[model samples]
Target: MVEQQQSDDNQKNSEPGVKNSIKKLKNKFVPGFQYTLIIATGFNISMLVIGCLNVHKCPVNKNIPLFLIATGAIGIISKFTTYVRTRFSKHIQVVYFETSLYSVESIFFFLGSYWVYKYYKPSYDPTDGDVYCNKTAYLLAFIYLTFLYSLLLVMIFGCCCAFCCLLCLGSGEDTSKAGCKYSLLVAAICNFAMLVIGCLNVHKCPVNEKIPLYLIATGAIGLVSKFVSYFRRRISAHVQVVFFETSLYSVEAAFFFLGTFWVYKEYKPSFDPDEKDYCNETAYMFAFVHLTIYYCFIVFVAFVCCCIVCVAICVSATADTGVKYTLIIAAALNISVLVVGCLNVHKCPVNKNIPLFLIAVGGIGLMSKFISYIRERLSELVTVAHLESSLYSAEVVFCFLGSYWVFKEYQPSYDPFDETKYCNKTAYLFAFSYLIIHYTIALAVLLACCCFTLCCMICTYKVRTCCQDMVSVEQENDTGIQYTLITAAIFNFAMLVVGSLNVHKCPVNKNIPLFLIAIGAIGLVSKFVSYIRDRLSKHVRVSYIESALYSVETIFFFLGTYWVYKEFKPSYNPLDRTKYCNKTAYLFAFIYLTVHYTILIAMIFGCCCFVCCAMWMAKAENSRSYDVESQPTNTEAREALTTNDESEAKP
Candidate 1:
């Protein structure tokens, strides 16, 4: 009786485990979760639509176009798969569903793997001048385009590879792996073609123009990785990934990660729900930032090392050792500044607006330089006088002078004269362009000035540390350091009172939440700057708690300020737009932040819930859970035994 009762409980409990999961699935697929899923899926589909439209709009095969196309197609298919899995049959579906999911992921992985191999080019920003261009852009097309082209090639090849793997682990042993075998063949062919194209490009391009050829080779690698993975995976259900092979695979995957990101960066998406927008696109930006910063920092160090060697040669050649010593000391000073600027993003979070104005001035200088460089290259075609005058007062100053013109031309719906014409489904090809006019030159100027300041700080620090004991060097360092310190002190004071010297102004109208956020941030900056100014300090005018809390209250004060600003600014309305749901600008920012945080929380929670369920299931095994009637897919031997028992029985 006891044994029978225990057996019954075991069956009942175990049965509910599957039932709970099935029930959960039904709930998730049916209504609440389904709605959001559809929305997200639909959004991606819209982006795919835009991408497809754009591909035809400005077709180019170098790389970006294919990537956008592949991404759009893959994303739509993924969403479609979700819909099928949810609405379609449930049993034996997990394997098929998994296969589908893996297939989609493999496409991205393949694309990414090859992208990593693409030789990187310079960013769009004129500030990072590894390669100077005729134009400037916040969106670095060269870097981005190169990466995408690489990834697309990889993904195409990878899909073939995936097919091969699927066939190797064929749905049934009796069924032929024809589908996978064919895919393997195609992948192999594409890889060979890639090698051919790569070698061909090498000869076509000059040594200096080896960039184009390198990019092509990177693209080929992406395709090859896809081919290899597909062939191996198809043949073996559990292909043990060897370290040597895995390292090669890792390199392949890297191309996709790096390359796909560049493609994404170049996407000038319209307000298409399908595309990742300003807030959502931050993730892509971060990825680019990681790659670019790492790339720049490493390359710059190399450049600096080369420059140091040259400087040493220059010093050795100098007739006067005293002057040579002074020059070397100066060189050291410059090197220090570069180091410090690299450390904290040249203190970008500090004075931006003033730097912006300085950049505008610098823009004039660079415009002057570009025109002269071109004129020398193409002598007698363009005059120096017209070029020089055009730069000094022609571009940005005119725009600034015409601020009133902006107000006049501003259609309530759109900025009629908005310079940046980047957007939509057909945006990628177009997005690869640069603004050659004053904008680029001006932005570059600002960047250089900012760099100058950062360099100054770095040099100052180096002099103090490296020349602490040296008599003559110490004296020089003391003077230069004094000047740098004074300049920084003035800048920080200004920033605290307002914001970055580059673009800052105290707006009469303020959104409270943003203001509050700013206040809290500024307080932190103030404390940081104060610490930097003082070598050591113990005294406080007020208690730490009082001052800290006061800083936090700035946020509240700003909220109150905004409420007043809102009341006063009667005509200024954000919601009068014909298109776009006026979710309230500040409110939207907060909401966006909330949504991001919520997604993170939900993922963590979902993982925890899975762990809990698994643990509970493990404990339930204590009871006599074995049932004679239950047919488990535990082992082929057990199934064979059951078949033998059945055959022997003479029913």
Candidate 2:
């Protein structure tokens, strides 16, 4: 009786993944995850039924059943597969069949994306009666379907690939392997087929549409799959080589952006000119067309390649084959980019600084993991954390001294404690102060972080060799300890990734952190220079003209201020400088002045003092009094005085 009961339970457990999947798959024959499939089918049916009755009255020739029930049939099949898998345990046999089905569907989707282009050719003249086609609709549906599979296939193929590679995704942790495997298989097959179909669609012609709807459909599947698969992570791997290779497409996008302004920039240079003489520019335009197509193909191929590589890593790592270099490489790329940003931000000439925030953002993920790793090591006070934190404190002094010396020598405004007058960027001073404090603490912690990582890596290496149990979440839970460890870990982690990417992308192949500091250093230097300029200027308070006279230095001061603000906003409040009134209030006043000036220019008594001065100078240079020595200044003439000094000279 116990044996029979055990058998029943085993059967029951397998049903959800396998049997339900079959049911879902069957239901798909009628309906699926997306309602659009049915809606599309219905619309096609309506068009078919309606068009037949009034085929003669139709504005232009159109396809009837070309998009009707048959189109919907494919979706129904897909849904049925999903439902069936949910009902039972997926055996390898069930998974194999599911994979096959999705693979078949992927092919049909590719064909559909381009089917209309061949049929509905266009004519320039309306009199030609050349039937027009909404190739867009077909492409849209194809893309929708293809990606839908991509989402499903990621898991399915991941499993297949994992099984082939690692022998299994999980040796024992995985349950419901029955129907689940089949669902996974279906998903994989869908992804594989979509990749294939997407590639085919890249060649579909989309001229009149002036858009690559078909190509978009192919690419959208992978992107959508990625998004859905991610949630869509309960959801879904070598994101590096994949994303990097895919960046080739980004180059395409870059070219596209450039072409809008630089018509000649491209993978294959093309021309765009007067339509009257198409030949001259046609070659150029044709090249752009080919390049665009190439990019589309690259996008599709990369999506699949990325998925495959990521999965391969997971499988290899899980199987203990030591295939972790790609992960490291990805980590490296992220860091490199961030470093590049840091360096370029500082190195690039003011007003043309590369955006660093965007580059650093990509490393956030690596940062998180790094922090987790650090938390593991630093949780114990007796560890390297204490020594490193202290060391950071010492580095703070040197960092500040270096910055101070550079500023005082280069920037005449290098007063850390002195009150600043109007026009001084108070916020910048505050940022420097805050940076002094934070950098001290951060350096200490990061120093600890670096030590901890190296030590941990050494230990991890040993542990891996010994085949010992790895640390789990339960290993470190102390909040205070966790905080110190995590922060240090995060900082270090970011550093590691930055370092691993060979620090090439950051500052675009330069040391970003150093670059930021250098930039701040330069800005600090300029501040002092600006202060000296202020002291030397005739007007103690220089406004518009003085600001212009001291343009280069003045601009550099503001650029430095901006860098401090952008790079260190969290370290200090710009308004607290006590330097030039409140930073916020000062900026507000400047803004108000600008607005007022704008309004004045729009009105009449409207001539701004600046504009008036310009006009006055222009007129004065060519006046009738040109040869008259000091020709009784204009005021004397206006006063009707004998163009002389006061009648009663001073005694």
lDDT, model 1: 0.40
Task: Tell me the tens digit of each residue's lDDT in model 1 across 1-651.
Answer: 999999999999999899999899876766675576667556545544554454323211223333444444445444555554544445213323333333334444344333422323324344545442212111222333445566666776566566656656656643244565565566556445545555444423231222223334444654555454554554445443222223234344334333433433344433233533422233333333434554565457546544544554565453445644544453443344333323322122222122222222333333333443334333455434333333432332323322222222222222224334211211111111111233355446445544654675677676656754668865676567556645644443433233222111223333333343333333333333333333223432222222222323332332333243333323323343322221233343344334534664574456346545754775677443655335456696788998999999957
Which TM-score value belongs to model 2? 0.22
For each candidate, what is the lDDT? Answer: 0.40, 0.38
| Candidate 2 C-alpha lDDT tens digits along 1-651 | 999999999998997879789787777854343355445445444443443343233123333223322334333443334434443335212332333234334433434444543444343244545453334433444455456556655764564454565435445536554455555455445434434543443333222222233223333343333333322123223122222222222222322322322222122322233332222223234434544565476456445545654565455434322324434554454455445544443332221112222232323323322332333333453232322222222223234433433233223243434424111232223224434554465557445544654575577666655754745443443234435544533443443333333322222112233333333332333333234333334543323222222222222222333222222222124343322222332232234334533553353222234335754785787574675765676876767664344555643
**Which 10-residue span in candidate 1 carries the lowest summed lDDT?**
425-434
**Which portions of model 1 show Cα errors greater than 4 Å?**
1-187, 199-597, 612-616, 619-651
TM-score (all chains, Cα) for each model? 0.22, 0.22
Worst 10 residues of 2 by lDDT: 349-358
